[model samples]
Target: MAKGKDVRVRVILECTSCVRNNVNKKSTGISRYITQKNRHNTSSRLELKKFCPYCHRHTIHREIKK
Candidate 1:
């Protein structure tokens, strides 16, 4: 076993609803969360269920490119 170059990488999670509902004026400036993931243990993109202040509900937050 060995550690990869990107052992820990910074990632951003954005609200799925906010991105889809762009027409909504309130959806402006989508909510996002910053986090770090283990590249070796979990190389795949991470999707987390988090609360969105604008949406005011738990939404699927998917990892996005920096």
Candidate 2:
């Protein structure tokens, strides 16, 4: 038996607006979403437009390290 590389990996995406706003003011919480991505195809960080409850608008969410 041999070990194989993981094709799909779980990723966490956080709201960009919330992250920048948090520096100036205190926020209740930042919007976060869990999703899966193909490592071989998406070598760079994943970003998507998502709704943020805190910001109350669709913003760009970037992948963060675990």
Candidate 3:
């Protein structure tokens, strides 16, 4: 028997606002989050609303390549 691929995979989510406007930012970094998702369940990219320290508020964080 062979091992199969994992259904749950780790993904990196980044702040959309930070990536869009990177120049002259209040913070020198972009907000990111690590989370696991089921590939079989949702094929599309993941989008989550998370708190961003730099943005100083909650923003829509979209999944990005690691």
Candidate 4:
């Protein structure tokens, strides 16, 4: 068995308040909330929210690659 370097996991958080607010604002709405700066550093090992395929929802946890 061997470890793969190319494989990586990402966490994506979905805030309900933010999502609703953005939807209401229309033009300047989306940009006002979400930002590229919020994205997690791939190299960091911090727990975060990610889209889960099994649960069909976003989950907050640490991602591991086998």
Which candidate number has the best lDDT?
Answer: 2
Compared with the true structure, what per-residue lDDT tens digits does model 2 show for residues 1-66? Answer: 433588889999999989989998867788999999999999999999999999988999999999
lDDT of each: 0.88, 0.92, 0.90, 0.39
Q: List residue ranges in candidate 4 displaced over 4 A.
A: 1-45, 63-66
lDDT digits (tens) for residues 39-65 of candidate 3: 999899999999998889999999998
Cα lDDT for residue 33, model 4?
A: 16
RMSD of each: 3.4, 2.0, 2.1, 12.2
Output the better candidate (2/4) by lDDT.
2
> What is the alpha-carbon lDDT for the whole of candidate 4?
0.39
Error of 2 at 36 (Å): 0.3
Per-residue error for 19 in candidate 4, Å, reads 28
| Candidate 1 similarity to native, TM-score | 0.84
Per-residue lDDT of model 4, residues 1-66, tens digit only: 444433443333343333455556632322111112222345554455555443345655442332
* RMSD versus native structure for model 4: 12.2
lDDT value, candidate 3, whole model: 0.90
Compute each candidate's TM-score over C-alphas.
Answer: 0.84, 0.88, 0.86, 0.27
Model 4 residue 14 distance off true place after TM-score fit, in angstroms: 18
Deviation of model 4 at 54, angstroms: 0.2
- The positional error of residue 13 in candidate 3, measured at the CA in angstroms, is 0.4
Q: Which stretches of candidate 2 lie over 4 Å from their true place?
A: 1-4
Q: After aligning candidate 2 to the native by TM-score, how far in Å is the CA of 35 from where it should be? A: 0.2
